[model samples]
Target: MCGRFALFTPIPQLTNKVGAVMSERDIGPRYNVAPGTWIASIRQASEDSAPTLEEMWWGFRPSWAKGKGTQPINARVETVATNNFFKSAFAKHRCLVLADGWYEWIKNTSPKQPHYLCRQDREPLYFAAIYAKREDGRLGCAILTEPARGSSIDVHDRMPLILNDDSLESWLAPDLTDKETIRNLVGHIDADLIEHWPVSTAVNKPSEGQGDELINPL
Candidate 1:
């Protein structure tokens, strides 16, 4: 699961990559982004609107289910389509969770090792996500995760569902809500393009460090 990640890439580069416009709030770069906090995302508000950069609370709990269920941070891709709590958003509110890389732990180690995984080319990475407005009116989201692939399997049994560059626009298109059609048109970034390396354990405490040094090779 994508419990912690980073999104220090400049907003201009993020917008240019996704053909989106900037949002009103200023989101200063942060190297240690934790759940329950607002994070950047790219989404289309409606069929007539272009995609825009916006901030969404990392945890998801639909307004309708308020006070009834858990606010999940990660939604498994295999069941998100059929899950009662997530299916509505999965069908109409898909978005991209922007990041430079994410952190995962090797649970077998004495002090579980943290690894930073990102595209080999260091380009912007976008994780597939679905969002819903909370009772307070703020948008919240959950990153989609799938069985680990490639080098990611070395660190954890699951990883975020990253969308390939070619699939970005199609994934956000408001009109293409059919689950089967979406699965066919939107594909993940090749697992082979993902690379990871052991990083400083500082990432284990999301509140302890906010520097790039946390991602430095150990």
Candidate 2:
């Protein structure tokens, strides 16, 4: 699960790459984004319009849940289409959770080492996510995760459903609502295009080590 991530890219560069207009001009760099915090996401207002960048809560809480239970930060891809909690959102409220890189733990080690993973070229990572309107009328989102593949399996058994530039349009196409079609858009991410390395474990605590140095190779 993508419990933590970083989005240090400037708002202008990020908007340019994703083809989104920024909702706010001053979205500062976030080096250690955690669940429950507001994060940037891309979504279309309608099928014919361009997508826009907006800030949304990280965890997803269904409207009927009334904020009384545990809100999940990640949804399993295997059951997302059928799960009662996520099905409706998966069908119509799909979104792109923006990030530059994500953190994963190597559990096989004595003290699980945290690793930062990102595209080889350092482009922003657009994670497949579904959002829901909360009881309080606020929007919340959850990242989609699938079984790990290739080298990523060594760090964790599951990884966020990342989308490439080619797949971005299809995944964000507002008119596409068929479950099977949506699932098919989640094509294989070339593992070779990804890079990872151990980082300081200071990221383990969400409130501390939020600087760029936290993601530096250890």
Candidate 3:
């Protein structure tokens, strides 16, 4: 699960790369972004709408599920399309979550060892996501995750469903709602492009980090 991550890239540069119009200009670089917070994403208001940079609450609870117990931060890709909780959003509210990298902890270690994973070239990673209006009518999102593949499995059993750059526009294409079609059209980024390293355990406490040192090699 992608519980913690970072997005320190400047908003202008991110928007330019995403081809999205800047809608929320005041978002600053965040070096230790946590769950249950407002995070930035590129999404279209409608099928024909141009993508726009907007903020969405990181936790997801569909408006219909108000008063229900769960607000999950990550949705498993295997079930998202068929699960009632996420299917509607999966088909209509798909989005791309921008980030420089993400944090994961090695499983079963005496003292959990946190690692920072990012593209080898340091280019931004775009996570496949879906959003929905919550009980309070606020927009919230959940990152999609798949069984860990490549070296990422060494750290955790699951990782965010990151998309290849070529599939970005197709993933967000509102007209392509058929589950089979979506599955066929989108593909993940090359796992070889992802690299990870041990990082200072200061990241163990979410509130205690928001600086470059949090991600630096231990």
Each candidate: RMSD to true structure? 1.0, 1.6, 1.2
Question: Residue 175 lDDT in model 1?
Answer: 91
TM-score ranking, high to low: 1, 3, 2
Worst 10 residues of 2 by lDDT: 182-191
TM-score of 1: 0.97
Clashes of each: 0, 0, 0
Give residue 110's error in model 2 in angstroms: 5.6
The TM-score obtained by model 2 is 0.93
In model 2, the Cα lDDT at residue 87 comes to 92
Which candidate should be chosen as best, given lDDT against the real structure? Answer: 1
Score candidate 3 by TM-score against the native.
0.96
- Model 3, 1-218: lDDT tens digits are 89989998887787786588897459877878889899999887777688889899999998888568878999999999999889999998899898999999988875788999888899888899999988888799999999887788778889999999778888878888898999999999888888899998888887885889988887
TM-score for each prediction? 0.97, 0.93, 0.96
Query: Largest TM-score belongs to which candidate?
Result: 1
Residues 74-101 of candidate 1: C-alpha lDDT, one tens digit per residue: 9999999999889989899999999999
lDDT of 2 by residue, 140-169 (tens): 999999888767787898989888777777
**Residue pairs with backbone overlap in model 1:** none
